[model samples]
Target: MRKLPNLFKFDEISDGDNDFKQVMVSILKKEFPIEKQSFFDAFESEKYKECAEVVHKLKHKIHLLGLEEGYILSANFENQLVNNSFELYEDFVIILETIENFLKNI
Candidate 1:
């Protein structure tokens, strides 16, 4: 199995303030699960537009986590959803799993 990158840009978040880092981590812990579920629910309902919208929202988190390739994959996935392709959905799933696992360790 391929290992996910250490994507969290901790130094960027840390930037000297420990409190800011803690707050950011707290927000991520709270928000990411909800966002993940929203994405899954939208996909399950075949609401491709809603999936795209959720992907758009998640793109920020992808970048914040410093998953540059995952970020690009997400953009492509969003476009695929918009086009009703569904081809890249599996890749998006892998990305989500990678993120979820990474979050668990932090």
Candidate 2:
């Protein structure tokens, strides 16, 4: 099961009803696989622009989901990739799959 506070700080950030968090989690669960496939396909095609764009958006949701370490790591990697660091692609593969699983469980 997904951890409460760790999955999100909704207890403190929301009105005890998890309005925002619930919406985010629902969207994430629904889009996880599509997003995962998109990332992998982009990476395989070396389409850094598309991959970075998608990952940048994913980072925002991840930050709000309370996966701060992952949010930071992914955002940084995406930024680097967009700026010109193709070397980060391999590392991104590992983190992307991890994040995909993390969100899927929600």
Candidate 3:
């Protein structure tokens, strides 16, 4: 399998402390699933506002993961959700999948 791009900013996180890194990883591990489930539930139920809320919450995790471009895309995706636009759904899903895969490796 192809190696994924680095999804973290180690040097910037906790000043490169290993304990801090572990804490960060643990936090992401715990929170990602909840955020993802919320997103899926809202999306499946056609609750655009709820979806937007979840996306907004996930956006902070995206930035913490050092996915700068994904962060920008997620902001757009959140707005699209608020507007009930499906135009960017596919792209947003791709980003989510990438993050999920990356999280697994970490």
Give the number of the best model, judged by TM-score. Answer: 1
Shift in Å, residue 29, candidate 2: 0.7
Q: Candidate 1 has what TM-score?
A: 0.89
lDDT of 2 by residue, 3-89 (tens): 221454544565566787687567767776677788778877988899888888767756766766767778788888787686666
Measured with C-alpha atoms, the lDDT of residue 41 in candidate 1 is 98
Model 1 regions lying over 4 Å from their true place: 1-10
Candidates in descending lDDT order:
1, 3, 2
Q: Residue 91 lDDT in model 1?
A: 85
Candidate 2 ranges beyond 4 A from true positions: 1-5, 11-14, 18-21
Please provide the root mean square deviation of candidate 1 (C-alpha atoms, Å): 1.8
Q: Judged by lDDT relative to the true structure, which candidate is superior, 2 or 3? A: 3
**lDDT: worst 10-residue window of model 1:** 1-10
**Candidate 2 positional error at 96, Å:** 2.9
Question: Candidate 3, 94: how far from true, in Å?
Answer: 0.9
Quote the positional error of residue 24 for candidate 3 in Å.
1.1
Q: Of 2 and 3, which scores higher on TM-score?
A: 3
